[model samples]
Target: ELFYPKNKQHWREWLFNNHHRKDAVWLVFYKKQSDRKTISWSDAVDEALCFGWIDSKVESIDKESYKQYFCQRKPNSTWSKINKEKIEKLISTNQMTKAGFKAVERAKQNGSWTILDQVEALILPEDLKQALAGYKNALEYFDGLSKSNKKMLLYWIISAKRQETRQKRINELAELAGKGQKPKQFR
Candidate 1:
């Protein structure tokens, strides 16, 4: 469902009433310059975290506003570094609801809470680095990529459980990067 929350409190009320039942919500937020006042994205995220929800894809609705999708955190959802910090703050501030604490506990029990944290500083694997070295353009392109893009590529490659799968991904990445393209998943 789409929601236009006027402010942080409005969003909090909506989540309080519907967080347990709604599968997802598309929240509309006004741009800073928009005449219509709305909750800022940062505040919205903090509020969602309080309810054990997470935000994902954002799409522009118009010049004035955009919509972001928020949903209940899945059992296997991996927590991001920023979200982990946010969770800590929320906990310290006593803003986290029971549902939010439950979600954090589930992640801790399943070991997803610290998985991303351990790899927060994504390192380029030697094998992938060697492969990219063979393609100068690929190396240059990979080097110039934004941190998030590089992290996504590295995570996708490293997350492969099998050695052969990881090697295949490295080769594919080199080939794609040589062509000045990112992985299809990222694109």
Candidate 2:
């Protein structure tokens, strides 16, 4: 369903009314201008998270607006550090719903509520750093990567499902960096 709530109150009301419906997905139309009289996207995301919803893809609608999709938080969904902080604030402020608290509890129990900050800080693992150091082109390319790209590359390697996979990815990533290319799946 698509909705264009003018402000946070409307969005909150909608969530309060519909949050228990597990099958629903919302595509919220958001105006993206500092001066506009609309709920900021960040505020919308915070509100959704408070109701145990998660934002997925965002699509540009036009020059002035975009649409962001929100759906029920799935079991075992990894919690980003930023969202964990947001949940803390929401709980302190008494905004989190029972559903939201349940989601938070699950994350706490499963240990997915942590920062993947090594990527953000661009602190390469010893093994990956050694591999890069051996290839001058890779080292130079890595040094020049924007923080976001560096995070993506490192997260890809760190999130590998197995040790052998992680090692393979590290090697492949170094070769790609040496060629001044991004991972094929990076956007």
Angstrom error of the Cα, residue 62, model 2: value is 5.0
Q: Please report the TM-score between candidate 1 and the true structure.
A: 0.78
**Local error of candidate 2 at 162, Å?**
3.6
Q: Residue by residue across 26-93, what tens digits does model 1's lDDT show?
A: 99998888899899888999999999999999999999899999999998888988999999999999
Task: Give TM-scores for every candidate, taking all chains together and pairing residue i with residue i.
Answer: 0.78, 0.79
Give residue 74's error in model 1 in angstroms. 1.3
Clashing residue pairs in candidate 2 are none
Runs in model 1 deviating more than 4 A are 124-149, 161-164, 171-187
Query: Residue by residue across 91-118, what tens digits does model 2's lDDT show?
Result: 8999988888888888778755553656
Highest lDDT against the true fold, candidate: 1
Superpose all Cα atoms of candidate 1 onto the true structure and report the RMSD in Å to 1 decimal: 3.6
Clashing residue pairs, candidate 1? none
lDDT of 2: 0.80
